[model samples]
Target chain A: MGGGKRRRKLNAERSGRIAALPSAAPAEEPQAVTVADAAPDAPKPVPRSPYEGLPARAFWRSGVTEQHPLRVADLYRKKFALSPSHQIATAGSCFAQHIARRLKGAGYSIVDREPAPLGFDAADAQLYGYGLYSARYGNIYTARQLLQLAREAFREFEPAVPVWRKGERFFDALRPSVEPEGLASAEEVTAHRAAHLKHVRGMLKQADVIIFTFGLTETWEHRASGTVYPTAPGTIAGRYDPAVFAFRNLTHSEVLADFLAFRKRVREVNPTVKFLLTVSPVPLTATASGEHVLPATIYSKSVLRGVAGELYHRFDDVDYFPSYEMVAGHPSRGFFYEPNMRAVANAGVDVVMRAFFEAHGIEAAPRAAAEPRPKGDREGGGRRKGGGKRSKDDVVCEEMLLEAFAK
Target chain B: MRLCFIGNSHIVMVKSAWDEFAKSHADLEGEFFAASGSKMNGLELRGRSLVSDNPSVVDQLKATSGGRTSIDVDRYDGFVLVGLNLGLVNVLRVGQDHRTVATVGKAPFGHLCSDGAFDLAVKRQFDAASSRRIAEMIRSVDQKVPIAAVPTPHASRGITGRSNQFWADAELLSARAEQPWREQLEDFIRACGVAFVEQREETLDGRYFTERRFSVGSVRLRGMTERVEEEFRHMNADYGALVLQDVMPHFGSAA
Candidate 1:
């Protein structure tokens, strides 16, 4: 009789606890929910809106207001907080440089494992793609490029087509613009890439955060070997051969698959690393999809943004920063871009950085007045005195080569 | 002590500074043998003297050494090669990409190592080539003569003006090179069996660039007044005296 009475008491307690909780649990909540027991008849269970009490990003977001102008409010609600010592390693498409520069300026520790030689000036250093990323990998504009780089850096995954030759000069097929003038021989390029991989490995092992800005879905690659390149062949160094190389417009599924594979590989090496993802706000400089460049840019960014968003939901450590929506999205209009309507202006960078800091609870950073143009602007134009034809003051975008084919 | 100076347009400052330096050290006398362009590289060792290879080249050595066609290399107590391409950009070009501030995330440098091994190798190779040429010529004339190499000076910020917008990436390097680039250059020149005159530590701003007050004038440049109005790399007599000061200790010592 006493054992039966105790079972009855337990059932009563469970019902009381369920009755105390608010109508429903969050549909998309990750982790466990807390429950408490109360004395009596509580409110009946009812379905609650998933959007209720959701973060600002779950709703319509706008940073641009009549008063704030270029600035945005509630743009980034960070899932993680970065301290001054966070080892941030940045590498991605041409636009990614702006993010890296701002973080470094704000005094957050950027993981620069491979520093250039002493006495080099800013212009010459960048010409050789020195300060752009963790290991000098030039404008990694595609998901395939990012996945291959991670694989090449850590695993034994070597591209079957290792080197590309233009005239007598040899270039690393993966990242043709990195050497600027190109290497003397295939052996030199391999040796150089080996050393670069070491730095990349170091970056992977140590970085607390790796912000990858996906730039393009359009890619040209080795059809047989399934190798992807930073830029199309011939624009910078290699010759374009249809028989050997094939143009691929990656769909949403392909990008998502690659990112998942990248994340899995990354976990094998760097288990604790948190990933911050952003789709490049800059438009495509050229399109091989036989479509207008405008629609091509849209299609590319959309696929990338979609994959990145899904990845955010799929992985706990992966967070989406929405730099794409902040700059290219309709809320801010197109005020952040330069006259070229492609290059993101400093004010756009200013607001992006502001949101990043605000969301992460990092104090506002002081103005970096000594900066010339946006770091992304260096992706195209100009020349280095001692090096190749690269923008000495601005960014050097390989996509700018498309402008050459115009008219 | 008598000195013979060998240089390009950079020789003008040392020539101009001799008197002011002489006020403190009256024992020094110097002579110049220089011309513009590739002609400066044509200095040849004829017996124990240097002579002009080009007939069109001006031969100031002829006047300095009585009526001889060339000045006796052994006659001079010291030799200085001023204003060759000592510009930091020259060192920067030898595979040292010092820009650290940039966007996005890190990527692999194509056929290039970001570990600095590739860049350091390039720098070493360039230094070797330059050292080989200088060592061969200097040892040919006389191993005993104290020779110094002063590279191109960096452009002054005063002339360039303070900029806020363009140089966020330069923080990758110290105002001066953290690695002893001067010492490395000195070691290279010394391995060449010659002395290297180091730039003064105090005269530099953070970027390893020279100050504007020393930015006097260059004979090589077309439009230079007595006062330097821009961020010119060449130095004047006052600056020349500073270089000479670094040169003094080596000269009095046996070569």
Candidate 2:
């Protein structure tokens, strides 16, 4: 609670600080009137550039390439430190799953409220989206989706499109992937979703560290309620209705606004909660902007990175990890992506996670991910590493839905 | 016919029932070879001789049966392994999945889905039961002796005082669909070379929970930290009486 209150105070004070106005360039002085006595009132000192006397990370030239082959591990000057006992809950994209798994493996308390009951194995639990996050809300990709989910989980918002029917079985439109097989009836879906929301509510209140990895900027919104769906309607379970649903690629400002509002809501419920934000490094599977896919990926990632920066700057409880910069940066030389290019290679994910631990002062030796193959084979989706599980997280991108009808 | 009942804290309920019933039925005799909680896990099978090292459990059994340390396998005609886990935590953990979350107070409940996955999960918990150690210890002593396992009973349906904590986490019992779980468990216990004693139909609220009248409070438990409050997991004499009624015919006929 102190952390959140202090964050609000610091943020208020930051805004209240006089604008760091740039010092005006000196005009040629009149030689005769140069005496300090000329002006009746003394001139105020111009603020020095905020960059003055800052660390290498504050400057692009020294912080990035000059350090050559960038070390983004220390990229996170963490605003809040996580103790081993802190209950961490995460939800975002597939990359967010990696963060939860990494934190869990590192002996952090990942509060899984709705864990798959006893006899379920790890893989099946993940398939049904149970063990993947704190709750069964699956990979939340967009800022709007994250916002909508928090609202729904807290009972603050209820979407118009609650259930999507397919012949007989009904799916909770918000998290269609959560139940691998659709639920039996709309009533069953509603009951299960309520239980899920109760779990989410408890988890949000209990969590000390809320880790969210920003993935895609694009989202499909239900026109009537503005409900953000993780994937397009027809992509996963529900049928697409062009008249009812619309596509949105959120701008940096919109993303930042959504997160700020989200931060406000969470602090209302859990003022002590700290946030760890990261921009996903994996490239977009496809984009609807009609631009070249490469540039579209850049635009999406850029918007997310900008929001991450703003949130990190504005909130005392928020810190951004450069997982995006770590893998996608030129330093790694595209060595971390699989042959598919869209899927990030496990070696790349390993480097990203190692830096996460390194930043948080956690020991990296506990990693069973050590002792690996050549770390830099760009064409190495072959003989998939990290066994089948890691590959599952990689190859399955909900955005791949855009390519379902590719020429 | 003479019989021996060995278990953990859960058997306290069954033993109370059996002892009470035996008083009325002069033809039957029973002995308790069970321990409480962790003590049961430590049971040793030294050369086909099942034994407990807990002094308290041993002292109580000695007082009950006139100081017999090891089961003279030749003496008792049949053995019923009770709580030693065949009756406790694991059963309830698996069984919890089968109960519906009840909203109404004192209302009946049941599991809607009785598919293979649910049944398989329950059966697996049974197979992996820690109580199986006690059963195996007995079997090692005498290969042909009949051993019946009573899964720790689900808690009473009328846990009214702590309903908030109880309903939030606990699962309630259900009827028709509960049979597949029962059948699968029977098959599993049968495969383990032990007779499966099905719970009685008399006291059950509706297959998922038993009536409050059959519930036993924590005062009956051993080795538990003294609690000001009572635990509703163990059952009463009426419920325990039904256990002997369920298994007595088989033990009586065979012995």
Task: State how far residue A222 of model 2 sits from its true place (Å).
Answer: 2.6
Whole-model Cα lDDT per candidate? 0.66, 0.66
Tens digits of per-residue lDDT, candidate 1, B1-255, equal 887676555656676676687777867776666554335455566777656666644453343333455657677787777664443434433333422222101321223343343344334433533323444576686777777776655555553334532223222332333353555565666666666666777767665567767874543422223544453656777777777787777778321
TM-score of chain B of each: 0.69, 0.70
Per-residue error for B144 in candidate 2, Å, reads: 8.3
DockQ per model, Cα: 0.09, 0.15
TM-score of each: 0.59, 0.65
The sequence of per-residue lDDT tens digits that candidate 1 reaches over residues A1-407 is 69999899778867775444444434333222223432356653332554344543343432243325455566667877788888998878755677787788788898887665543455545655677787777778777888898899976588867788989888988877766667777877887777788888888888889889888888888999899886678866778889999899999999998988888888887899999998888887778889988898889888999999999988889999978888888767798888888887777887887878888877767655545332322223323334443333365556556566464
Range of the 10 consecutive residues with the lowest summed lDDT in candidate 2 chain B:
B103-112
**Native contacts matched by each model:** 0.17, 0.27
Structural RMSD, model 2:
12.3
True contacts kept of 1: 0.17
- Largest DockQ belongs to which candidate? 2
Interface RMSD of each: 8.8, 4.6
Which run of 10 residues does model 1 chain A get worst, by summed lDDT? A374-383
